[model samples]
Target chain A: MSDNPQNKVKIEARDVQVFYGEAQALHGIDLDLNANEVTALIGPSGCGKSTFLRCINRMNDVIDGCRVAGTITIDGQDVYSPEIDVVELRARVGMVFQKPNPFPKSIYDNVAYGPRIHGLAQSREQLDHIVESSLKRAGLWAEVRDRLSASGTSLSGGQQQRLCIARAIAVSPDVVLMDEPCSALDPIATAVIEELMEELRKDYTIVIVTHSMQQAARISQRTAYFHLGNVVEHGATQQIFTNPKNQQTEAYISGKIG
Target chain B: MTEPSNPSARKAQLAKRYRAERRFRAYGIAAISTAGLILFFLMGSILLSSLPAFTQHYVTLDIDITERHVDTQDLANSDWRALARNALRAQFPEVSGRKEKRALGKLLSIGSSDDVRDYVTANPSSLGTSIRLPLTLSDDIDLLLKGVIDRDLPENERVVSNQDLAWLDRLLDEDRISRQFATRIFTNGDSREPELAGLRGALVGSLWTLLVTLLASFPLGVMAAIYLEEIAPKNRLTQIIEVNINNLAAVPSIVFGLLGLAVFINFFGMPRSAPLVGGLVLALMTLPRIIIPTRAAFAAIPPSIREAAMGVGASRLQVIMHHVLPLAMPGILTGTIIGLAQAAGETAPLLMIGMMAFIVDLPTDVTAKATVLPAQIYMWANNPERAFMARTSAGIVVLLSLLLMVNATAIYFRKRFEKRW
Candidate 1:
């Protein structure tokens, strides 16, 4: 892998802390995600890896009594400032969840929802192109082209997940976050999602939280290992897996401890 | 593992479990049959009492219209009162005294001469002809025919005098009186005459009132539910509102009647007996009925849907408007229909707002004076007329049918969308 200095930082988080009521979930953390790169966060259960991923898109703001204290910037623009419109920020940064949840409407409507709300496509032909290309990029167009009017929930678990990915990218967001996107899928379906992620990294910056170490090694350019609300190691995937600096990272890779 | 090794004990345990299941099934069947039996009893009683109201008895009479009975120059303006009394007297030649003649007149309906006048106006050329007309029998004779007033009772306590009862018996023996199915009960509107009263006014008023209730409550209730359950912060204010909604559903419906009398009739200056005012008042009462269940339905949806929509860059409001609403639609519609059924049967509120009026014509518009089914039935039940008893029962029958139709529609939507979504 080439370490190019020309690669601009897409997201920067410094000393990030998250709390739910009186209980703190995430300790102070510093990490930078590069453009056109896939960064994977991996840890055991209750390690706050998913919580950190949620902070990037501000999805946790909907929860009552939950607070986040940190400076999170996207392309040097402050994401937490009062001047920032949360709705527009969300349109710029999209997400995919672990369970495949498609709207109870037609597949075309599911993909067109974001674009229609934001007035992204001026004409029907433009919206048609956006939907088709988004599905094609997600590796679901060829299978679903004949039945574009079918309900998205009618598809299989894997197809629904891909449809969600297509739905997320329909508005052309610069950053996409996935929270254990393949955890609910079978091994074969997991393989298909991993393959799709490989192609998506060329255009949009992706941040994924996964429990499977093999998935982190297979697709990510950079990996961060979390242990009990703290990130213990961060570097290239190859270097971290083969020759890590911390004993916890080494023991985690060797299966001595979670 | 040790328990399975003991075969005798295991067999006994299985037998006991199967026996318990059988007992539970029997209890369920017993409960359902009890409910069905009560419903059958209620419907059967109402039908029995209401059937007689749709038929009436008539007596045929013949009388020669003399020159004095008709003003031939302006024949169309002639009244039937003098002719009808002469016709009754001509049938019974022995009645000569004034008091006895008046008692004889009581055997015929107060509305009988009006019927004779209709016939004369239709055929005005035969002014001096002798016509045999079937006239409506009065309530005394009607009760006598139905055996409701006992002939064995002393004349002083009965609805008819001894001579009048004997005359009615003679008319029955001669086969001059006949029973015919009453059509005016279906064609005419509310009236002081019980035999001519109909349910058309109340039926149409309920139709319009329900339309207004649906228009004002459905969208407003569903939207309010969405806001409270999905968007509004769960703080003390919302909690207080939630508790009050629950209390509203349980509050004496008369409280809403008072509210309507205060807000809609007095404060708003709306027409007192108009369906428009009645509908607005019912909508206020029905709002809480629908909103509580709608919020429960929204709450029943899995949280994964909200999470999924949010993940796709949808705002909180968008998540509810686009995703949550479509899924919970069938439940919301069913709740709205149940609330409407409750509103259709609401009497106290309507009575408070002056819907208890004797309306003789179908209300042509929302602003016109109107009466609802329950209020109309209540008025008829309180009337002293024996004929109105059957009419009141018939109104109940019609009201039940309307409620059934609305509930059936709710079932249709429930079946259509419950599983599809």
Candidate 2:
């Protein structure tokens, strides 16, 4: 709605409906995520924001009896098309979970897992370089540089989450999806991740589903408020938080209803 | 309901809870001790009864294998029993009747002929000279020496006659009759005489059978479990298959034996009483056992680990091979080894496959006619001879030890490789 020519749509979703078995979870969602910017989706618990985030990389396909019906495109390619290889699609679109889920392996191997599986490096030195740069980008290189041989789970909570981020970006995906990456961290750790997100938006398109509105307003350029599986408000983050057009969005933002 | 804001009421409630906890602990201790007592009695009786089988009586004789009696050119055809009988007659010069001489010959085991032949064949130079050698005693005399057959029993009630007893007493006084460890129980194969019966044949048979069962069931069970747990969709067909697998585990083991007899022996023309057929039967019996636990092991793995791998662009097969398998390996191995242990102790199914036959020669390969440990124990237990009772108990001890070893290996693998997420 801003009519800015410089904002390019990196992923576009139209009328996306999701169903788990016989129970419908999301109904007809429409949203656009722009290139080199962060889009924040804020909703109450069980409001389908995480489900929508999982749709971009086809993560929902792995769940038994879970179906997503709609056209979701990344750079004009339909992700649900018959010819689309889900492995390649996921390689181009990475995801991080709510908890810090690093493989029970050495820290270097955890970050190199993606690159190795995707064949992104030609030699061990190239893989080492990829792991180093990814960790550096996630701001975890300084804390874990000397302990790459240690298990990823042996790290502190915030550091482990950053290691997961480094792992997600090691294959150099164009889009990164984060589902409440800071929910399990303390305020200081959350702040570190929020700062990392602001820096990550310079190179990768990011979509985050957060429960905290303040987290959305602090790091995201675009904001969408979801209620009962519907997008109630969508616009520039400043405009959506300050001057929302919808009464439900205002009620949620003002703590009147969730 | 007893808790209250008042301090005295809260204190009473806490005391009651503590008392209940202590009572529960007492019950647990009592249950464990009862189990321990039962195990102690069971093992004590088996060990006590088996002790007599460990030692055997041998009658040593100074016999001359003369050149005339033993044709050195025809060692295999030489009448070694006649030479032993002649030496025994030489011992009792005053007793000269044919029946008395036959009774005197009965003191030594029939197998002593084979032993003399074997010695003479090995040491040809000692044929003409007199050599002292230990000869195996007959089972009845062996039992008498071991106090299994009561020496005080009346003449008709006991298998050992007065004349035989007199000869045994004289030999004992002369230090010619001796009791030593029964090395033959470990070295020889099955025989009608209890003194000559050993577990070597049955032990080898069990080894071959378990090898076949492991090779047949483990991979098949694991592959089936992986398919059912990870890949197969939850539908009517898979649900039916799951129910059938559970039912298969509950089917009487004898039914699997019958199936093996019919399908493998009758239809496929596999050898009857072969370890190969017995192993195939046991494999069928243990398959559902392995699959159930393998599936449970797979189910215990957190789905998050799988999703994490998938998020990094791993294919479904790669996710299982790289992450899920390593995490579940300890559980899988424990389940498989426990299944094998159960199969090792199984007897009814092997009986249906004719493994209860009286096998004498050690099975050289899987397809040879053979019997397992439990089958051998069963055969010995069914024999009416008093000497067989101790052998039966000894066979049970050996079987129990092997089972213990297998179960211990299962526990060792579980503790050595178990991983925490």
Candidate 3:
């Protein structure tokens, strides 16, 4: 550990509440994501973990009747501010969905989509280099490099997910949010992605939502447990797994309550 | 595992079940064959009855184009009529030998020289050219040639006299009588006489009307569907719009014609029988059909694709233009083609707007008086001549071919744009 206070917090959420029409989905919740570390949010279905992840990038804005309230800031800039452009904000905070959603395009175009949209790479050569390096970093280049023109959907399920990851990283975002990125994959593909995430954390702050506690322990440096729309506890992965915490957190980690 | 039983009883039960199965299969086969038989009968009847209309018989004459016969320069002493009579006598010596030369001249329609006079006067450049004009054969002669008028019938009962029949047979034996495919049916204008009728005017009118309908309906339908499916809030107003669109699709086509009459022709004072007014009416009828299917296609797209596009920094408009619209293209095209086919087949609404009138010249513009294919067929079917029956069948064939072409185009585009994902 660097033990440096300068790398203290990258993202801060204070008393965030979300609603779908008249029903409340998330209660007021406070959390902080540290810089250059992987934080995993673990919870059961309908526990609002994915909802919280979506709010960070304003993905919930597309849903009809969905309203999010509270303050979320990235690097001291208010993400929920009226002046913030959602498109620019999303370009900064990229996301990978739960299911593998490789666009109905060639593998090369899938990764190039983000960079092309954000104007991150100026020329074709720069875009090609970005796609190659991003795919390499996602550990998908070896399997997919020869067939870049083939449809992204023609790949195996695991490769499609990695392609999505590569697409998210190609824009060179500050934070990468993954919503159960490995839930759709087998154990072999899951291990490959976990290794890729370990390498990715060196430059980008990563937040992952997963149902597997073992995965949370293996990949993430910090862990936050959510229950009934509230963050029950959060600490270092080792401390949260092995040491004292709230009873709900203990019960959830021990598999007594999801 | 099998339960032990008396062999004969088991055999009887099996036989009963087999009998029921055989009965069901027989019923299915009978139903299918019945449908096939009905379709074949309908198609065969149409093709068989309409074949004779394709040919028309004409009498060819070698009339010399003498300058004195066509020129009427002397105002007080004009004698082109005497000159035409002399020219007819010179061409057909049999007319001069007949005691009733006047009746023979009427039967041959020698007055058709008036048509030639008008043509030559209008186009003086063709004064020296010998044009083989195909004059309209009289309906009685056409029936006699086609054997629709029986010689066995008494003189008063039969439309053609025995003398006329004998003369027609001699003309046929001399090889002067010839039948050619009726090109005039496609080139000339509508007429009360089936022998002179053609679809040229009606076809032109339909083309103009369809052009207007396509221009006014397609974009408007697509825009309405997009707003309803993609952008509009799900409120009572949206629900009402949805219901109205569906209801409009089921509204009788003639109701739209009434609406058009009351609105466009009466209130707005647009020219009656003009293609513009007819097109507006048909467009109103077709809009709901196109919009409903387009909306359904837009709705079938997965919400995830839209979310992914938006998440990747695409604007709402960009998401729709780049993804949703392309995905929904096949359905939209199908809907449009079906709407066009329905519009092409519609007749009752056009009837209300005066599209059934006998327009003798091709429509010069959208504002010109016009008829359509179905209206033309309807008018021909009601004509007194038996020859029009064949003409009506030919018109049906043309209409069917047009519909087939439209459907084939729709299928081709649907296949081209179909996406597995």
- The global C-alpha lDDT for each of the candidates, from Candidate 1 onward, is 0.86, 0.91, 0.83
- For all predicted structures, in order, the TM-scores are 0.88, 0.94, 0.88
CAPRI class of candidate 3? medium
- Relative to the real complex, the DockQ score for model 2 comes to 0.69
lDDT per residue, candidate 1, B213-327, as tens digits?
8898888888889889988998999999999988888888788778989988789888889988888888888999899989988998888888877766677778888878877
DockQ value of candidate 1: 0.51
The list of candidate 3 runs beyond 4 A from truth reads A1-7, B1-33, B71-92, B96-99, B102-136, B147-157
List the lowest-lDDT window of 10 residues for candidate 3 chain B: B74-83
Candidate 1: C-alpha lDDT? 0.86
Best by lDDT: 2
The global Cα lDDT (0 to 1) of model 3 is 0.83
The residue pairs found clashing in candidate 1 are none
Cα RMSD to native, each candidate?
Answer: 3.6, 2.4, 4.2
Task: Rank all candidate structures by their TM-score, best first, as comma-separated numbers.
Answer: 2, 1, 3
lDDT of 1 by residue, A1-258 (tens): 524466788999898899988988889878998888889998888889999988888887988888999888999998888998888888889899999888777888888888888899999999999999989999999999999999998999999999999999998999999999999999999999999998998889999999888999999888899888888999888888888999999898778888
Candidates' chain B TM-scores in the order shown: 0.84, 0.94, 0.86
lDDT (C-alpha) at residue A132 in model 3: 100
